[model samples]
Target: MTMKIVKTLFLKAPPEHVWKFLTEADQLALWFHRGAADLKEGGDWTLVTNTYGKEGEKMCWGKVLEMKKPERLVHTFTHNHLKGVETTCTWTLEAVKGGTILTLVHDGWEKYEDDPFGMAANHDSGWDEHFGRLRRVAS
Candidate 1:
């Protein structure tokens, strides 16, 4: 058992609004963590989560591979604290009943298939917290 990209949805606002929150720098830091990105293809992103344990660490960094407006976004995810692993994270927005359904998926865990439990547990909780934060902010 290994990490299969976790996908979760949050329905609160329109796709355009949700897209703005995801792309904007200030809104992202408000709910998730303080970070910045050039936000273009092959551009870079930096996320510094001081609350992610230890004193202060600019832990996660990645490159933007694709950005398709309110429809989809694909990016590379890397944690400075975690070695030898990289994940491709994608965000897809779809129209739904009351509002937009935002789907966040992190693929590329199959490489660690032998350690399924740890991967599952790690991502399960992480997505819960992060998606919860996104819901609160998107609402």
Candidate 2:
């Protein structure tokens, strides 16, 4: 089975507003980890954290695959926690009646010989926590 973590969140803000939180460094720092540089397609995608493990250290680093403002983003993701294995994260934004629907699909784990549920569950919880903060500020 392919191990993956998918989450759908409804934010009380338009796609334009929600997109900023997903791409811009300043806006990302307010909800998620600190962006190491401007997020652009084909550029380095680095997110640093002060609380995860080390202080002011990169939590994840990879290359940005695709970035369509206010619509979608795809990136290669890897961190120390993944034991050097890389994955892909795709964020899709949909404009709704009064807000945006942000869906995150973190996949590419079809051969992780360990307990998939445990692994996916951990990341799933982490995403929920991040989304909680995103909701507060985006609204």
Worst 10 residues of 2 by lDDT: 110-119
Query: Can you tell me which runs of candidate 1 are displaced by over 4 Å?
Result: 52-56, 112-116
Please report the TM-score between candidate 2 and the true structure.
Answer: 0.91
Cα deviation in Å at residue 59, candidate 1?
Answer: 1.3
Q: Predict model 2's lDDT versus the native.
A: 0.86
Q: Rate the local accuracy (lDDT) of all candidates.
A: 0.74, 0.86
Clash counts for all predictions: 1, 0
- Residue-by-residue lDDT tens digits, candidate 1, 21-96: 7767667776676665536667888776657355346667788889988899888886743465677889999978
Model 1 poorest ten-residue lDDT run: 49-58
Candidate 2 residue spans exceeding 4 A from truth: none
TM-scores, one per candidate: 0.82, 0.91
lDDT of 2 at 20: 87
The alpha-carbon deviation from the true structure for residue 3 of candidate 1, after best TM-score superposition, in angstroms, is 3.5
